[model samples]
Target: MTSLKNVQSKSSKSCYVIFCCCTFIFAPLLIGSIIYQSSGIKIPTILSSINATFSVENLIDSPTKIIATIPHIPLESFICDKINISRFPVSSTTQTNDSFDVYRKNVLEKYCDIVPVPRYNWSSPKSYTENDIAFVIFTAAAFFHTRTTAARDTWVSRITNYYFLSATPYPYLPITVVPGAGEDKLSNMKKLFYGLQIIYKQQMNLSPDKQQKWFYIAGCDTFILPHHLLKRLHGLDYRQPIRVGGHWGQHDCPGPNGTKFQAEFPSGGAGFFFSMKLLEILQPHLTNYVENVWPRNSEISDVALSCLSHQLGVPLTKQVGFWAHPPAFTLGENGRDKFHKEPEPNDFHYIKPDEMHALDEFYIYQHMDRLINDRNWSEFTQFMRRFVASHYELLRKKRRECTLPTIEAEVKLSNK
Candidate 1:
């Protein structure tokens, strides 16, 4: 009986230990769950903040950092939201007059209606006149974090205020907020092509001379625009049907480090306008090539598009200064290291810290109440002035200022 009693006692102790172990293991988890629910915390948002903060440290922290460095954009933001492009006009062949006019007309005539005057409310308010061209920008949210409600409010406020206060309206330029699915990141991009096809078929079913216009897939963050490229397009055979793509920055090439460290492709963040004829051809074939190697995942979207175009047997037009190759905004050599090299007059430049904070401030202004709050409001307002003013000289002058090529080459290599 004594031995039986000892065995019972041992069993009871084991049960108690098991209960304690479970409690110890689950206590924090239970608490975290309650807090997460109560606080309305999104795991992705938290994770994005955590992920974006790591930077260079992550690349070196071996496999641990690599495993933790998954992209953390919110799930709500990832689900591809439908955006209607029906209102975007695709009329080609209105004029064959001026050389510059004919060049732009031929290149852009197929997928866009090139009018001398701005018909849409989406034109830049400051520059919107009777003769400004109306081109639609797509899925621009990735380029403009300030426009994203989840990013910096200051950035949102600045862009809005600049456009609105400046009296601008970006009407038909609907930003696609969702990330699409495919074997590659760009598999979802095919949906854009297919969606355009559906919209085009629905609209242009009637007219034999239905003017298909140019489709500008603009990268918002890039700040370069190559004028020589515009000049070159004038020389292409408009009847042959041509499409343009690339970084389309303001400068000549990627600064030093950008060329080396960054991916080289026909398209990138600044924006590249494609020919409507190309889209019409690719629209039908997009589904078959969704998993093809060209649209596969990579650091550069334009590069992927270029690759996909090649795989689909589409030819991409090559031109000098087409994409501002190195991109003056993010990865360029000129404006990146401001302390070391002075920016030329025309570069749309931002300081490193300023660029980082700009998106956050934009988010605060767009989605939160920091604008009215004194602490954030003052800082944000000053930031706007400085940010806008930094490029004020260039905007007013509108000159194509080129830096010394030797200097450009040197800055191209420096990552900073």
Candidate 2:
């Protein structure tokens, strides 16, 4: 009996030790998980802490580590990609007198006169050297075959990692048709929030190298100078929270103090650029806190986005590049709103299809004229973005008195 008692005592002590070790090892993780789950705000990762604490130098090897080699679910396995909460609260001001069917019908009917873009070869690429950038092309299905087509043909065609979130799916376009994203035409707040959410989920991981660090979000009508934009992002760390756009000092966005005076953000049409870390911090709040407190009153998508970033502690950082309006020779001031009174536009917003094609030429030939004629690549402006520019413009000068987006051109182009 004494011998049995001794053995049982030893067993009890061994069990106690094992239990303590487990608590020490997993207690923090459990606590952190609980906090994240409950608040849906701060997510604690163990990749080094959540991803394995890798060095910046180490990211060079796998710069796209966000998409795990083995995803939680297979990419092709997706039949539907709805968020946790599919619709806004019925009491919210986003509710409309017109049902979604009516809204979508109006959208389609409005753009029905436009021709559908030819299907792109999804398997191959447009041959430009891929960069660590992911594009969020916020589009409506109405513009899918027109404006988006123009963009895809020019610069977007060259980049393979672009995303299109449409109100309804275009069977031919490689896009995700989100449910509530477009139902409320009151504002583009839902669309913008879901867009970033989708992007964040697509590359959620601890591996910094496996994720595209820089994200650019713009409307389908916006024209992008990817090569020029890349220069802007050079040497910027992906881990830092960076937001760059037209620093329109507007205080109409939502604030942490339940007001719109907290944040000043960039123009949505011209587009905005952000780093990965800022996105990660904002990911959790998109579905929960954001939707709940979004403006029922006067809310602009760009303002709301900027305000949210400010609330999350990120401020707008701008440099010389954005063209808030479409390109006009006399539009920008040298050291003021743009680089040099020149239309050295990094992103041109509120443009039409013809202007997109024309602007493509305007930028392309200016470089070709320089390279073949002057042969000077200095100040980094010479190449035609040669490989990226359209072959149709190679022999022609489409920039001279061509169709522009100055209100009238869009009307004329639409009639044709």
Candidate 3:
């Protein structure tokens, strides 16, 4: 009876030992397999070293480190891939005003990917006088009171000769605004034609030796670096009827069945340069040209001018440094309002009214001097690149924070 009792005790002990060994060996594998199946993440086979470096709690709290451990994965792609959001539907109702607003918002959101930042190679400041170039500035009567004022207070003073091209009277600049045919695209073209007429008349009135070599046209919002522009112009022959400006590649026209057209015109925002010879060639045909190419409401003045250049068989030279979009520094409200307002020894002083019009004007007022005087163009370029990168980073962070909610709301609205 004693021997049988001892055998039963030994058998029970052996069973207990087997159960302990199985739990110790198989529990971790089971847990890891469950995690892998659910989350599509492979659990590391060896955890002892990993645990020594990063605690499980720390890894849970900071998933960014875990994401970093993954190779060649962008944070945006990771987050966006993880979140399942429905796309906003496009229907016939998308043509409505409210839907158009949403469409425009969507388009603007994609600008970071579409539009490229402008870059220019720096040249040594050349010895060219103000008399070498004349400026024709385009503005509307609506914007004249504000945009025109901002322009005059800034870079306009740096040049000797500049004419305001508008239908309205601007006596503050003391130059009569040249009247266009009317305020429409065709009218704006006529205004430019009229401006050319005026410049031609002035040139005809002057002695041949005293005539200017280059004619420049810019919008009120454009910031001109006179020294840099003059340096660029100096390299080209004033004797030839050359057209110089930034060029855009093939882009779709603004219509439902928009066809792509190759545009080699300078961006009007960055401004364009016409040699005196080219202006002279254009003078004789200005009236007829304006009458024939009567601007369609959808036609852009710059593109039209480029087309005209092609028709005239003039060469279009692509130069850099012209910016179509405002710089990153002049993005926010504070940057637009009070940038470079602090008085400096050599700075141009102007009383910026309580009401301001364009941010580009303020940006020019702030950085014109620095850009003109940049002895180290490479350094300036690097600084600008860094500034733009930082701006985009912050913008990306903001977009990421709000993307989920915005997308969800849009999805709900679409469903309704």
Candidate 4:
């Protein structure tokens, strides 16, 4: 009887220990998630905070730090929220003469009508307009005449506050030189970080009337449709901390210390966005993060920022329609038309100079709604499929390109 009593006591003690361990290990995470999801307030994760602070012992213990750092952002704001192209929704009785214009004139020219601009009764007193969005475009000396020019001529004009940055500046062009940014493997990454810093500083100095509510960060190689982009932003709550993009996945950055740090980030080429509230949170941390964290960063600005954001508990909310590559390369992969069959895309990356012009003109002349008349669009669709086949290899990259193979995306944010 004594032996049986001892066994029962031991089993009960073991169970108690196991339960304690589990509660200790998981309770904070569960609580943190619940609070964050419910309130949209980012609670700086204790573990992530500790990891970053100690990542560089040199700074943590040193009294003379590189710069004064803002320890944390108050959990005041957090909010959250891409592209594909389709053909023929609106038609103009008078369409510009292009190769495709000939096709439209022969078939659906008479049916083409200008789409009426949408008017919204906004809940906020201030509605989002072209002035409300600022664009920060990454470019290089090599692309100044080609990609940059194409972008300027096409969509870059809508917003008054647009910046083109490069490591090597061409005074003749709109591109500005980033201090200490080099034209190396990590050039684009450097540009990304420095560009944000520029936006934060420049926007903060602007008068209230000129301040931007949203910021779009993209490469010069990307072709963006301002109309569609604004449409997407219109539905979002700009007052909250919002980070929206297409490319998102975990990436590993191996430091000189031989440790591999991982972060989930959006790809830079297709473009990403930040709400004004997010920019304010990030602005105070940029100097500290660049000084302390850049050394251990993935050397990709997007991934590096993702790591910093992870520490600060910022989430990358994903959206569809940010096409990774031009239609020619991606059209037939998931069965031709399967991708375009979806909603009209906002942007396309990995496009050539001519391709940018072609796409810009297409969207300008051809209407984007597939629901207009299936019969008319079907013929145009078949023609585009043949065009895709004939021009399969529009531009070839000497180095392997960093592109998301699919347009598939997801919202990885808290419930709010």
Candidate 4 lDDT over 1-416, as tens digits, reads 44777767665665565565556545776676677668653433322211111111222222221222222212210110001111344345755544343544443232112111111111221357666888888887777767887776656643456888887766544566787767665676667777788767887798876788888888888988765666666567777888888756888753446667676777777787888888878777776666665763345676777776666677888876676677655564544455655345668889888767766655643332221212356645644664454233222221223354687688688886
What's the true lDDT of residue 52 in model 3?
Answer: 15
> lDDT per residue, candidate 2, 1-416, as tens digits?
44777767665665565565556556766776576567543312222222222122221222221211211111110101112222334445566745433333433222212211111111211222246888888777778768977887677765657887776876544676666666445436667787677667778753666678778888889888776666566566778998877636666555456654656778777788888788888887877644677755543777777877887888888766676666453243333333444334467777788778756654543434334332345422413354535344422333432466766444444555
lDDT digits (tens) for residues 59-178 of candidate 3: 122221111121211112111122233234556643553443353344322322222211112344464566788888877676665666566655565466777887776465545456
The lowest-lDDT stretch of 10 consecutive residues in candidate 2 is: 70-79
- Supply the global lDDT for candidate 3: 0.54
How well does each candidate superpose onto the true structure, as a TM-score?
A: 0.33, 0.56, 0.49, 0.56
Give candidate 4's error at residue 208 in angstroms: 1.9
CA lDDT scores, all candidates in order: 0.36, 0.59, 0.54, 0.60
- Error at 140, model 1, angstroms: 6.8
What TM-score number comes out for model 1? 0.33
Q: What ranges in model 3 sit over 4 Å off?
A: 1-124, 184-186, 250-263, 329-416
Of the two candidates 2 and 3, the one with more favorable lDDT, higher being better, is 2
lDDT for predicted candidate 4 compared with the true structure: 0.60
RMSD to the hidden true structure, all candidates: 27.0, 26.8, 21.6, 25.4
